[model samples]
Each structure stands twice: as C-alpha cells, then as structure tokens.
Target: MIKKAVIGVLCAGIALGIGIVIGHFGISSGPSWLKDVAKDVDESFIERFMAEVNTIQIQENLRELTDVPHMATTAGDEKTVQTMLRRWLDDDDGLDDAWREEYNVYLSFPDANNPNKVTVVDAANVVKHSIREKEKPYTDDQRDPDVVQPYAAYSPAGHVKGKLVYANQGKPSDYEELSKKVNLTGTIAITRYGGAGRGAKAINAAPYGVAGVLVYTDPQDINDGFMSDTNETYPHSWYLPPSGVERGSFNRDFGDLLTPYLAAKEETYRIPPENIVGIPPIPIQPIGFEDAYVLICALDGDAAPFAWQGAFNCTYNLGGPGFKPTSAFSNSDVKMDIYNQEVIKNSANVMGIIRGSVEPDRYVIYGNHRDSWVHGAIDPSSGTSVMLEITRVLGRMVKQGIWRPRRSIIFGSWGAEEFGLIGSAEYTEVISCSSFSLTLHGCSYTLEKQMFRLNKTY
Candidate 1:
C-alpha cells in the first residue's frame, strides 16, 4: 500500500511541473499552448509599449520645446511650430499625417519701445515714484530680451491718473463696500490679485467710477506670507519673488476677438474695434508685490474691515482717496500709463493625426497651447512636453504597425492661447459653426488645466 501511494505522488508532481512550464511560456510569448488556461490577458504589446515610454524622452521633449519663450505670433513661436511639424513629419517615426492651420487672430502686446508703468505723481503733475517696469532679472531666463515686461494684455492703451484705493480683488462687492466708506470715483484701485478674473478686476471697478486698475500679487495670498525678500523666492525656494508680476489676458471672452462667430480666415468678416465688449474699458496694468507694498503703505484712510485685510505688515485701508499725511506720497495721485495695442496677426495651429483601424471618422483629440506669457515653464510648456512624449511613443508604434487605435487620435498644438483660446476657439468655430451656430449663438471652450481632450463623434 505504501509503494502504490509513492507512485501516485510522483506522477502528480511531474504533471504540476509541466503545467508551470506552459504557463510561463504563455505569458512570455502571448496566446501560446496554455492560452486557454491563462485566460488570454493579451498584455505582451501593452508591456512592450509601456516599457518604451520613459522619463528621459519626456525630459528631452521639454528641453527642446522650451528652448525659447514662444509667445503667439513671435519668431520664437514660429520656431516651436517648425519643431512640431518636423517631429510629426519625420520619415521614420512620424504620425500617419500632420499639417498646420493658420488663422488671422486678434492679439495684444505691450509697446516694446514704450513700456507700461504705474507711477505716483505730485499735485503739481510731477512724477514722484514709478514702479519698476520689469521684474528684477535674476537668471538668464528672467533677463531674456524675449521676456516681455508684465502688462495686462488687451487693456486699452491710455494714460490715466487718480487717487489710489486699496480695493481688495476689485470684485463688485469690494467696490460696493469701499464706495460706502468713501467716494471711489476717479480712483486707481491698487487691487491685490485673487478672488476675481484679471480683467474683471478692472471691469468691476468701472461702474464704481474707478478710472483704472493696478493689479498685484500679495505675498500673503500668493506665497502664504512665507517670505517676501528675493532670496526667499524662486531660484531659491518655491515662493514667487517680490518683482514677479502675474501677466495674463485681460479680455473677457474666448476665440478671435475680431471674428467672433466666423472662422478667423483672412477674408472673414471682423467686428469693428468699437463693437467689442467684455474688456476693461479703462487702462489696467499688473505690478509686482514689491511695488504694491510701496503703494498700499502710502494709503491713508479708515482701516479696512478685517476680511479685506491681507498679510501686509500695515493695516489695509480704504484710501483717503490719496496718500497719508506722513507719507512721502502725500498730496500725490496714482497714475497708470498703459501703452498696449491690438492688431490682427497670423497664428498657427499644428495638427497631427493617427488614423484609426476600426472607426476612422470618429476622433479623440488631445491638445495643449504652445504659447506662453513668458518662458511659461509651468503654465503650458510642462503639458506640451508630456504631449510630445505621448505622440512620440504612439507615432513610432503606428509607423512600425505594432498597434493601431480603434478611433482616430488628433494631436493639436494650439496657438495664441495665452491671448484667450484664440487658436482652439477659432478652430471650433470652423468645425462646429454649422451645427452650433444656429442653436447656440456662442460656443465656449474652457481648458480645465494645462491640457484638455475632446472626443468628437461626428
């Protein structure tokens, strides 16, 4: 009986060894003799593809894309356009197809020769103090000539001066509270940045009789009041330096400002400049916190309510509508001189496609703006880098016929996005106006973060 049991155990052990060998081979080679037993995970191609995608390629894409500051319509932007085209059109590892779309979009720029500025002028109209037109240049990136001085884009170019009022965030409620305390008319509200859209900062102030707006980043709000000095900020730590002003489009809507309903083709009908709305009617500019500290400290009036106060050392005040008696800016008014201009320029949208094997007409579009306010290392370039890597991996695979998506994949590098989604918006108008134009007067596209995707069924 003992000898019979030993023979049965030996036979069972040999069967187990054979099963293990077949399982290993099935996993390695995919759909092998043991496929039925392994349930056919079909993970071989997926494993190979994921292995090919690595950090080094992603970093390389970032390094190449951000080599220069590529604001829309600038020469630097053209370079980036070429880079995308070259990559997508490469013979060996390129997409199935790639092309460029051009649109004549309206854009804004600060006068390069005559920079925008905020100043304190004496009652006699003599300039007493002027905030620095540009941030303190610490590195080559900051000092780059292409780094445009911080200014409110699309703010009508004009010079206006009035009493300085600390209107927190320049929201409508803020203006209402300040107006109840003191007259807000003919004042240049030095609003700290937050709680409102950049353009709304000025637009909300307009009805309260605020003539102009000077927006700035408060260290408390932006940096959590960790540190205000240059040493404690960027290049040293994560905080923004005192001179780092947040620059952005001050316009209210998306798409080409000139061609609202139509595609921004060269021959598209454009609305007259005077017909435009949703922009600050008054001149506006953004200043650094260092300059804001100087302006706010000079304000003399009743202390603001606790909620309106920020992390500044001094008590936030409803301006005496001017300056403190003890301040050097006494009897002086704040001045905002903005020399911004608007013009129609050609912006490029680089579009690439990977045709699907099953549903060729259906599409999944992945895109990021290629333009920046400055180097825009964070705003858009970071997303652009990740997108480039994705295309590289998928493009190579498609080129070699390793795998194909079920639906078409469209990669778009949009332009003039910093100016308010001009590239993507105009493209939408061209594609969707036939259907959405009659039902919806306007189509709004909001980018959730630096990147967004759309699945187009039609």
Candidate 2:
C-alpha cells in the first residue's frame, strides 16, 4: 500500500511538471476562425492606426510643459494644470461626452510659519557676482539666465551673509567629518549637488545654526571640461528639442511637507496645516560650480580632505582661519512672505472612449499625465500627445467603418500628476468601487453565449 501511495505521488508531480512546461511553451491549436480574426485586427486596423502617430506633436508638447519652474502649490502650477485640461477637451473632436466626467484632488503644503521655508541670501548678489566673470558664458542664445536661477520652491524669502564653509556634498557623512575635524557653528555652509536630494541638505543645515545653504553642480559632475564646444557640449537629444533636457530642481518627499500625518490619521486623506513638515528657518539655494568657486576661494579655514576635491583644477580645502569662536560670527535674520490660499476647488480629468461592437463593456484604458513640472514636454506631454494622436486616428477609422474592435478602449489625460498621482489614483478607486457591469466576449463558450445574447437584445 505504501509503495502504491508513493507511486501515486510521483505520478501527480510528473503531471504538474508537464502542465507547467506546456503553459510556458504551448501554442493554441484552437479554431482557424479565431486566428483569422486576430490577423484581420492586426493588418486592417492596427497597422493603419499605428501609421498615424505624430512625433512632431509629441516633441512640441514635451518642450512646452518643461520650459519653466512650475512648482506644486504655486500659481504657475495651477495655470499649467488648467491649460492641459482645456487643451485636451478642445482637441477631442466632437466625441466630447463619450466617457465619464472629470474631477480634482487637492494637495496641501506648509504655510509661512512652517519650518520648511528656505532662506535666500544675496540672491541678486549671487546672480550678479556669478554671471559674467566667475560663471561660464552661455553658448546658446536659448539659455535664459533669469529662468536659470537655482532656487527651490517653498523656500522662504530672505537674505543673510556670513562666513562660508565648504561642506562637500552636504550629506550626513560630510557633516560627521566636519564635526570631528572642525567646528561649524553659526556659519553658512556651501555644498555641492551630488549626494542626496537638495532638501535633505537644507534640513541638515537648519539645526547647525547654518545661516544659509548653497548647493551647486560641480564641473566633474555635469561635464568633463569647464566649457564644451557649442554644438557638442549641450545635453540635447533628438528625442528632446533644443531646450528639452530638464534642469529640474530636487525637492520631492513623501506625504505633504506642510502637514505631518499623525499615528491616528496617517491613512486619512486630508490637507494638514501649512508649515507642518516643510523646511524653514534657514534659506537654501543651488548654483553652478562657477558661483561656488568664488565663495570657496574666499574661505579662510583649513584645507578640505582629499575626498572633497572638486574638478576645479585646484586643491580642495575646508577654510583658512581654522576653528573660530562662536562669538566671532554673527547671524543675519532674513524674512519673506509665504503665500497660501485655497483657490478653486475644481480640476478635471480628460477622457475619451471608443465603443466595441462585439463586446462593448470590456475596457482597455490608455492614459498619460497632462500636467507638467514646467513645459513638461518630455516627462508626460510626449506620451500625452501621442495618446491624443492615437485617439484622432481611431476616430477616423471608426468613421470609415473599416475597423470594429472586440474590446472597448478608454483614453485619459490626467491632471496634477507632478504634485502626486492624485487624479489617476482617485479616478481608478472611484471607478473600481462603483457597481458597473462589464460584458466580455470570447471568454468561454458559456460566457460568450451570454454576452452575445445580451448584445443582441440591446
């Protein structure tokens, strides 16, 4: 009996192995009619549809969205969101009401009193001092100095000047080394751009009584040489236009920085008070190494470690005068207005649908975010524009009566994606939770019969 049981188990295992192998490599030997149907769908419809994709429109949309510094919780960002919604609606070409309507999801940040406000010092001075003599000349006419100011959004406006200290990448480890070797109390810290996010550096500086924080991209980080040949040096790609490469700011963190979700309300969805989690107290800004070099050269402290060496073709140092008494340096108090107002409580998602003749309920949805950080051409507009072109082509196909899909298609252009994936996530949850029946064809003999009967009656 035991032998028989062991043999039975072996046979069951063999059967399971066979099933796995077949599932991985098996080709369906079903009806020839199904193959013919699939072939027709590909050749007659999908081929023609694919040919209509417009690359030009995709590039144009990407360039426009990423062209500016549109931070969340700002007027510029709101305008950008509305502009995308309007453009998608206008471009729908008569199929305006084919899908469900749109809605908005609100995201809140800290108010002025919150500690997240970053202080700025010598803003004009840095721009003026670094532009002509210290900074490299712009090779392209398209590069705008006004727009290129390296300031983070939500930064509290202020100006303070103190003795500057080179803090390497301004990471935790860099600070640990500074604490051990040198005293950095009551002084401004200048850091370079690589390690972690820029906000992390600013947050670190606040407790150290750091009057201000300055971040910049070193020459070794961005390029090998101080300046590159005009045409070859710029980071342009065919997939991107002249201004397509995004020189974006680094200020992203989980949850709303202005409001801290407590243990009880962590999962709850609601905007907290402004100035909850955002970095305030000290001012922070990022700059190019050219600007950083001018400040570093003026430092009167000990030389920095070998690891802190920059690509400046010079020895890296901490400061010249060494550790100074805390009383020697003075802190300048700066101030700025933090703007916070709950404006319009409405935003929308643009959606279009193409109904299926055989199975009208089974949906295949395609979507992309319409809102951008700036012009947002590449990050999302490239994909959004392509989706739009596909919609246009599919509409034309339907008009000609040459194509009839088996599954319904829903297209969406989402808003406020940069702030968070609020629009898409909310829409999905609402649709999924709502009671809506979907009819699917070619599911099984019994299911297909029911679907076909329902379609016939309707």
Pick the lDDT winner.
1
TM match of model 1 to true structure: 0.85
TM-score of candidate 2 versus the correct structure, residues matched by position: 0.59
Q: Encode model 2's per-residue lDDT on 4-67: one tens digit a residue.
A: 9999999999999999999878967777556544654356455566666566755564455555
Lowest lDDT block of 10, candidate 2: 443-452
Score each candidate by Cα lDDT.
0.83, 0.51
For model 1, where is the 10-residue window of minimal lDDT? 433-442
- lDDT against true structure, model 2: 0.51
In candidate 2, stretches whose alpha carbon ends up further than 4 angstroms from where it belongs are 1-44, 56-150, 157-161, 228-271, 278-281, 320-349, 353-365, 398-410, 418-458
lDDT of 1: 0.83
Scored against the true structure, residue 186 in model 2 reaches a CA lDDT of 59
Candidate 1, residues 56-110, lDDT tens digits: the string is 8767777887788888999889999999999998887789888898999888899
TM of each candidate vs. truth: 0.85, 0.59
Best by TM-score: 1
